[model samples]
Target: MRKIWDIHGGIHPEENKHQSTGTAIGSIPLPPEIILPLNQHIGAPAEACVSVGDKVLKGQLVAKAQGLFSAGIHASTSGEVIAIEDRVVTHPSGMSAQCIIIKPDGEDRWTQLDACEDYAQLDHDRLVQKIRAAGIVGMGGAGFPTAIKVNPKSNKHVKTLIFNGTECEPYITADDMLMRERADDIVKGVQLIARFMGEVEETLIGIEDNKPEAIAAMQKAAEGTDIEVVVFPTKYPSGGEKQLIQILTGKEVPSGGLPADIGIVVQNVGTALAAYRAVRFGEPLISRVTTVVGETLTTQRNIDVLIGTPLSFVLEQHGFKAEKKQRLIIGGPMMGFAANDFDVPVVKTTNCILAPTQKELPLAPPAQACIRCGMCAEACPASLLPQQLFWYSQAEDHDRLKAHNLFDCIECGACSYVCPSNIPLVQYYRASKGAIKIANAEREKSDKARVRFEFRQERIAKAEAEKEAKRLARKKAAEEAKKLLAEKADSPAAANEKTTSKPGAAAAKPQAADPATQKAKLERALSSAQSRVERAQKALNDEQEEADEARLDSLRARLKQAELKASEAQAKLDEFGKAPEVTVGGEQAIKDKMAMSPRDKLEKNLASLNKRLSTAQERLAEAQANGAATVDALKMGVEKLQQKVNDAEQELAQLGPDSAAQGAAETAPALSAAEQAIEKAKAKAAAQASMSEEEKAAAKLEALKARLEKARARLTKAEEEQDENIDAFRAGVEKLEQKLTELSN
Candidate 1:
């Protein structure tokens, strides 16, 4: 015999088990309609797999498990899906949740199933998958998915397996009846779970002294095996996972820790039988043995009720006297809550449908204030300070509640049962636990968002730094180029080359230097100014956040200055292009050319022709030697050069000395005439430059009139020809007219 230990605090409520244990487990008639809530477990809700108007067979998957922590839901009988909407569910808050409603067709037909003759041939993971596919959960009312509980982390080695047959709650005998009837199946399930646990050291079934028949049946089934049936004194709430572990192994599970953390696992006997049927017979958890008891019902016994059967239907089957009913509860009287509506359906976690008359179970009076009594603390199975937790809960001090380890409370109603003032201590604890869970979830979400925001800010800062570095590099390169250009422009060699490359080099030297060089410098200034304008504009546009007003104003001002500079540079370049070129001392150059004699001019011409002929001959010879593509053109040029040389020599030979002098004297007259015209144009430009304001305005008006007339004529011609540039011509005419009017004003 294995010795059993005791927990910290417990209460022995009135044993009401005999009321439902008199008869064998019976089945209720098929309900006309069933209501299956999507969420029947502790985690995420299941997702619906069927739609309304779809025909489904018994044990068919109507909703799938949403995640690893949730359980699947199936049809309890062959039926047609009537509705898929929110309906009142078996929740503590009496709220509505998404559910699947079905109308049975009276035939309990089943779908195809995948059963394994021998579970030992499969691996541990395969067995767990089978259990998961069957939608089995902790049938002891916690409704935690069994698959998740059975599969612990690889590092934690399970040494003991405990089957909880201690149905210590008042007016609930579902597990007790199940143990008495399905002992062999329960033992087989224990063995299968032990094999899945990988070499568990010991297997023990913990039952109370009140269930002698269940204990003897379990012992007989567990005989000739390592499994042991351990019986202990009857106490309320000893079936809690933590308390049971303590009773069986004398090792208390750590606060806020699971039973697996201590190398032990406890499961209800009903859950074990469900696993056995799921793996061996391929039957999903479509129904459960629910104890339908209380004085309001004439027939009080355990019944195999289908999941999703309405509470009203179960009551009707038991000949319920609604007039005598005081309150309708779902679980045992100690831990169960009053049902707000009779339409709420049964779920996997439901173990009993308790309906008692007012004389049998009366409602508690209004709760009174606490007296700081230590009885609640003494009766607390978790050994927590209940009075202090209650005070903090009333104050809504979540921090204080956490410090008192409020999550360790099992909500078994022991504290409330022993309270002198009937404070409903368990209700306060439950509400506090929910608030803490929500607060923790919100905190985790806020932390993640903050991390993401910080990362985004860092990325933007890095990009801005890189952009600023590139801008600085470009600015330095532009400055260096400007410096090199200035140095080249100011060199003595540049001035000398500019002077010698123009016509009448000696006379033009006294005028301004080359306009091309100045224009190039102005163009560089314009480019730099434009670049600054673009950078400033980009800076303004990229400022997305609340920036300093002074900085924004400064950027705008810089952009305006850059634009002004760029416009000034562009105007200077345009003025430079429109300016006419002037040659000074033209008369002296004409006189020097006219002074040459005819014989001298002929000889000069002959020498120029001879020089050209020699150059052409050299190019022709080079082209022939290198096989150049321009060989034919070069040969033709050489022939032309020889002919010109012959003509020049013949002309030079025929000219006499006196004839050369006379020819030079006659050319002087024509040269004198051209110089007079050049002088007249220079005088006119000088007079215009020195004109007063009134005179200048009159001259500009006259010029505008003449331009307008010419533009109008061109516009008329373009219109006649239907030219594409007619609009441009018309625009030019309008501008000239506007200018003429402005100058006149």
Candidate 2:
């Protein structure tokens, strides 16, 4: 016999085990349908692998485990899948989960099995995989995956493997009945787990003194083996994992820790039997022994119920008296919850379905205020301050509740049982635990959001700094180029070149007198002036329509100037004549102009327009900086010059590439500003024309990305200022984003 250690607090309620133990473990007839919930255990819910209308076999893997902590779900009987949708499941809250409903065909067919003649021949990893595939969980009610408990980390050596057969709860006798009948199978499972654990020090089966028949059967089965069947004084809640560990090995698991941490592993006796069947016979956990007991039933005993069998169906098998039943609860009364619906199906974790009469298990009286009687404190199995935790829970003070070790409370209802005030102390602790978890999750989410926001701000700031650096670098380069130009212009070689080229430059000016060339220039001037006039007139009309006096006066003045320019351009065109034929007197002049070539003429024209644009832009900037009245007129003049420059460059581009090369070589030594601008424009056009469609798309995508960044910046500024055009800026940003996405794709 092993010396047993007792826990701090416990209370023995009425032992209602005799009602279920009178009869042996029995099986119910196959129901018409079985409803299997994907999530019958803790951790992530299993994902269904079967669809409605699919034929499935008994022990078929209908759902696969989602992760390591979860367990797979198997069909209980050979059937056709009828439905796969949300249905009421066996839960404390009576919640609905994804279920696979099957209609039995009465055949009880099974898929091929890979049974092992001897589990000892398999390796540790193979054994664990086999157990995991079996879908076995802690049938003792915690529903923790059995594979995870048996297989600890390599460094954490397990010394003891204890089987829990205490069944200390009020009316649960599923394990008790299983032990009395299937003792040898349970011992075999214990040996298999011990082998999986490498070299466990001792194997012990912990039972309470109240279960004498179970103790004797387990001892007889454990004979000639190192496994020990240890019995101790019966106490309420001793079946708890931690409590059982303490009672069997005198070792207490650390708070918020597991038995594996203390070199020990505990598994429910039912789980052992399930594992044994799974490994030895290649059977999945399709059914479990469940105690059906209560005064509201005509018959009360343990039933080998198929997983997913509806509670209503099971109750009908035993002649349940609905009118006499006060409440329907799953598990034992100490830790069970009232089931709201009879349609809820039983799961692997359901040990007992308790339906009691009003007189047999009457509802608790209405809760009264706490009286500080100290009885609850004495009866707390976890040695926690129930009164303090209850107070903090009522106040919704999560920090204080955590400080009082509220999570350590096993919610055994011992404190509530001893309370004179009838306060549901355990309910308060459960609610507080839920509240604290939610609060912690929300706080963690907030922290992540804060981190992301800070990271975005830093990225934006870095981009801005880089942009500023590039601008300064470009400014410096331009200043250096200007300084070099000035120095070259003052050099003797430049002076000699300029002096020598003056006559040719002067000679080239006379070509402007040619009738054909002069007429074309005047026509172009007229077209540009008319375009400016239209733009200014439109601006004035828009202002007038809006009745905005501030911009109307400036717009009118700009329109008047544009009209004057247009009139002068028309007069020049009329004076020059529109006829295509030139007079004999100007025939020599046309010949001289023709010698310069059309490409040279267009290039020179582009150079002149570029100079004029540069001057106009400078004047506009100065006027705007000084807040001058001519700011609007200067801006209009700059726009017109830019348009003329673009037109000249386009005409130059129309000339053949050979002509462009010839022109570039002729003006290579001392390139003018307009010549340089023409060269750049021509090169750009040639590059674009040479590019493939994909290359062009890539370039456009890059430009769109840049535009989107600038637009987003503007939108941010507008939003910060609460500007009236904030919506317009936001729309612009979205448009740019859409374009970018399309181009990227």
Candidate 3:
């Protein structure tokens, strides 16, 4: 006999478990359809791997775990995925959730499985993955992913691995019958879990003394090993993870903490068997032994029910009667919720299909005012004052509810079971807990919003300060320029001094030319200025299309500068009015200079063609080197430019130009560099969209390297006090480096 520690509060409910334990475990026939909910466990829903109308073999993965806390889901039998849509699921909220519906083929075929006799030789990570792949969860009640549960935090080492075989809930014998039939498998799973935990010191199996057969079976199976089967007295709600831990180890798990926090890990016996099948036989959790017991059913026994089987079908198999006002509970009466609709399918957390008649388990009388009785408090397993919590919960006094440790209540219904007023105490606590959780989440969101707003304000303030500093600096520069101009204007000697102080100013001065030559140069410069102004006006006045404002402005500015130079030249020539004959000859000279020979025109055109060809060739090479999609277009552009260059050279030769002048011939239309860059970008995007995974990864790696270099430059600048937000800049550098390392690995 093992010493069983007494918990704070408990009740001795009628043990109706024997009704379902008299016979051997039965097998369930395949239902017409199964509805597998994506979120059968306690975390994020698993992602569906199969689509509608796909044929899937039994035990094939239908959905994969979404994240670290989710479990995989496999098909219960060979079937076609008829639909993937929202359906009724086993949740207390009575809401429809995403589920996969399958139509069985009656073949009972299985997918290829990989069994391992040498699982112990596998590394720890491999074992965890195997368990996760098998979809093992805490079958006792919580339905937490077992793989994550078995893995304690890095700082904590598992010492005691307790198997909860104490099926203390009323009218639930699923675990008991499972132990009696498959004790060896359960024991093997226990050993596997210990091995996974790096050799847990104590492997204890806790079973109620009322389950003599189960205890004996486990003890026999665990023989010749270090596993211990601890038998204690039968007590209602004794199978809770925390309660069992205290009973077996005389240690209490701190409030709102896990047994793992105290170096103890608990796994339900059914979960252990599932782990055994997964590790040894490579069978996933496609089926479970569910206890179907109630007066509404003709048969009351445990059956190996396939997961996702409809509750109505299972009840019909047991000769269920359809009544207008019948109760169908999904678990033990104490902690189970009423299922008004029978369309919901069985899920991983379902332990019992209890359909007790109103007579077998009658409804409680309506509640009366509390007489300030301490009876509810005395029955609270967590030692909480239920009366206080209930009043505060109704009043919506969340602070008082939390102060009274309302979250620690497991809602086992022990208080309601013994309540004289028949108050639904558990319901109040559940609602209060939900309210508190919502309030806390809203508070967290508000805090995050506040931080973002403050950060944005700070950024705005910094930007305004920088803008003001730049404005002040520009004003100071203008003031200094104005001061120099005023000093020169105040004195003629100061202006002369400034000019003489300039480097090479005296050396750059030129002697005056003869009057004939000077007059000719001035007239030629004036003609050139007039030609520029006419060209600028023609470009601006073109009506075939909209003129570019920036281009027109640039031309106008150039024409103004040319006119200013021509005016200065004319002024210098006016000083030599003694040359009247030169003025008449200068007009003829202007016409001769403006009209170029055909060979000269051809040479100039060829030079432009060569420049375009060279630019196109450079672009093509760059595109090819970067593996850009613009390669083909750039290559075509280069070929076209090259052909133009060749044609220009031939034309120059035809014009009777010398061989040395054949390089220039005809002008070619060319795309601006900005337009070329835009095309390159579009082509690159198209190429990236068509790339394979590996190619995409390579491109991403290159991009990350470039970004990393930029980040490093920014970090260096920040270090040199060139910018603020040094911490953010440093973090960006580190983040880029981390991404690079991951990609490299």
Candidate 4:
């Protein structure tokens, strides 16, 4: 039994093709001006080789190819480029791209160019270069760079060349007519490609049976060349490159990969004609055959149009008929965009300007929910689960939609056509895909900011804590050292009394008693001082190390900060000690804890106390500083010092200080000058307390201004990228102002 295969596809959408293909080819007169878009292919836009004031000739290379993947632009007729700026393009985005506006002289003069013979003699790389320079791109719907299709340096296994003469698309017969008229040129172009493939195995030209005339013409054209022209059964999208390749070679291209991966290369019939021009005439691809067909047009012809010609002009030339008009489609009604505006340009891939009226092709009604009917699934050529994707996409469940292979759906509009629900399936899929992309971008940016900000804040906090611990240990060592010295000096005074007792003086007492007391005190004092120094050593070891690079760098920064702070703190400390107490009649100096934050005011007081202690130690430098003052002097100053210290200690204890007290003492040098007062505060503490409220308010204002400035800058950047956030900016500012007012109140 012979095997029969039929791939899943849509119902027969109305062709309405008779209006254009029924008539023979007719000539279109040149317009006064022809607009040329710099980009007509699916790669980098061509760079303008001709300036605004420069003149050009018919079929002259006007724009240089931009990149290896880019196509070149040319002048279709001798003209002057009056402007090079944004003009409408037949882009799915419906947005304008850069274009060159030409005012043609209508004489259509040909530029002097080098036409080559024996193209096989040229280097393969050079051939590809010429093709790229000539601006030849895939003319079959997709305007991919044609040079890219042939140069499969990456994949050397492609052994077969397939020529596509299968114009299976409904209502468009441009390729069919071209094959009928230029079959010999098309075959010659194929041989030129065969020159590169080098002794190619077998060349195959596939056409659908519906185009018997094209197949007959190609059969004669390829008569003795070993190129086999086969006719396959008629089918929609048989003209599709991958689809036609499968029908001819029985090869199914793996998803997301190309035909080259499977040892095959496909070229369209019209593309072959362009190749012949590139090789034989040295002419670039500047014009294309546009099928003007529909009930709306007064006259329909396969007009050769210059690229970037406005759709409006094309429609006007034929006389627009609005009678019973429903929609204006750019390509065939099966898979094409309905024209929202008439300013779109004719690009390299534009095959037809299909204007089927309501009577010709009626618009469907409002979409109804899917009833789980599988007509859409059956119609899907890629074998996707359309209904499943539709469900997730409508619910905005992006992950599920992707998991169901939504990307594979090709937006052919077939699923919607057979859909009993009349669902606009493609629209939902497009919206979901766009939303998913935008969401991913936002998430990535947010994650990056969070990581950087958190790490910075953590580093700052850890550094401050490490510096504080070292300072406390140093202060404790100083206090203990002072106590040991006092104890050493006081022992001498007591020992003297023991030696002078009258009853036992004669027998027990000796002149050595004073020296013995002095020795005991010296020994004890030396031991205590050594212990103090040892403790300091242990603390210094634990505080920070030179080996931990990050920690060391942080400490060096903190030390500089501490040094800066010490200068300011010393000044205030000196002032406090020097200023005499004011004589208010029987009123003790009141330092109410509530009047100011312990963190600042307390630091000022602590600095003053430390300064007093430092000054007292200087006088006793010979004893405490040098460990050698006389016993009596050491005892006198220390005994009195301990009593005054006890009273000052009592005041600190009564403050009921918490962790803030240690922090206050820590901030003695780090703290800046005391703030004066808050503009508004509670009456009881208003006079003494100072607040950073005014400065904070000013800072907030500046921050808002900076945010606005940055938003403006971001908006400018967004405009360049074709993604603006002006509405988002305005909404956020409104929310910010509301929050600020609530906080202020």
Off by over 4 Å in 1: 480-496, 501-745
**TM-scores vs. true structure, each candidate:** 0.69, 0.69, 0.69, 0.59
Please report the candidate that would top lDDT against the real structure.
Answer: 1
* Candidate 2 lowest-lDDT run of ten: 504-513
Error of 3 at 697 (Å): 69
Choose 2 or 3, whichever is better by lDDT: 2
Which residue segments of model 4 deviate by more than 4 Å? 1-5, 198-200, 432-745
Q: What RMSD, rounded to one decimal, does every model reach?
A: 15.6, 18.0, 20.4, 19.8
lDDT of 1 at 91: 88
Between candidates 2 and 4, the one scoring higher on lDDT is: 2
> lDDT of each prediction vs. the true structure?
0.86, 0.85, 0.83, 0.71
Across 1-745, the per-residue lDDT of candidate 4 in tens digits comes to 1122455574565555567766666556676567777778776788888789889998788788878778888788887888888876776667787888888887889888668876767888888777877888888787889888878765466688988887666788888778877799999888877665655576788887877778889989999887888787776666676676667767777776778888888888888888888988788887888788888888877878877677887888888886656888888877677887787777789988888778777888888877997888888777788888888987999889777877666667778778888898888888788898798989999999899779767865765575566556555655666676668657877679766778744564233323334444444444444443444333334446424766555554444333333323433344444665444431333333334454445466666566655664564564555664132343334444554665466666676756865666554543222332332234425533443777666666667766666556655655664433456765666666665566556
- What overall lDDT, based on C-alpha atoms, would model 2 receive against the true structure? 0.85
Give stretches of model 2 more than 4 Å off. Answer: 465-480, 499-745
Q: lDDT by residue for model 1 over 247-351, one digit each (tens)? A: 888899888888888899888899999999999989999999999999999999999999999999999999999999998998998889889999999999999
lDDT of 2 by residue, 1-745 (tens): 4688989889989988899999889989998789999998989999999988999999999999998889999999999999999998887666788999999999999988879996788998999999999999999888999999888998899999888999899999999999999999999998998898988889899999999999999999999999988989989889888888988878888888888899998899999999999999899999999999998899999999999999999999999999898999998888999999998988999999999999998889999988888998888878889999989999998888888888888889999989998898888888888888888999999999999779767866875676576557656655765676688669998699667775534453332244544565676677778767867775675457655776787887677688668756764675456335555677776545545645767877787678667766776788789996455556556756786887688777777676665766655554555776898899999999999998998898888887898789878877885654688999898888887777667
What does candidate 3's lDDT look like per residue over 1-745, in tens digits? 5677988888999989878988999987899998999999988999999999999999999999998889999999998999999987898878899999999999999999979998878888888888999998999989999999777778888899999999899999999999999999999999988888886888999999899999999999999999999998888778888889988989999988878889999999999999989988899999999999998888999999999999999999998876622589989999999997898999988999998887888888899888887998888778889999999999999999988889889899999999999899999999899999999999999999999779767866875676576557656655765576576567888578667777855564343344534455565555555555555444445421455777766665555554445444443454345334445567665455335445765677788778666766776687689996345445545655786788788887776734543343223233345655797799999998899999999989999999999789778867885343578999999999998999989
Model 4 worst lDDT run, 10 consecutive residues: 671-680
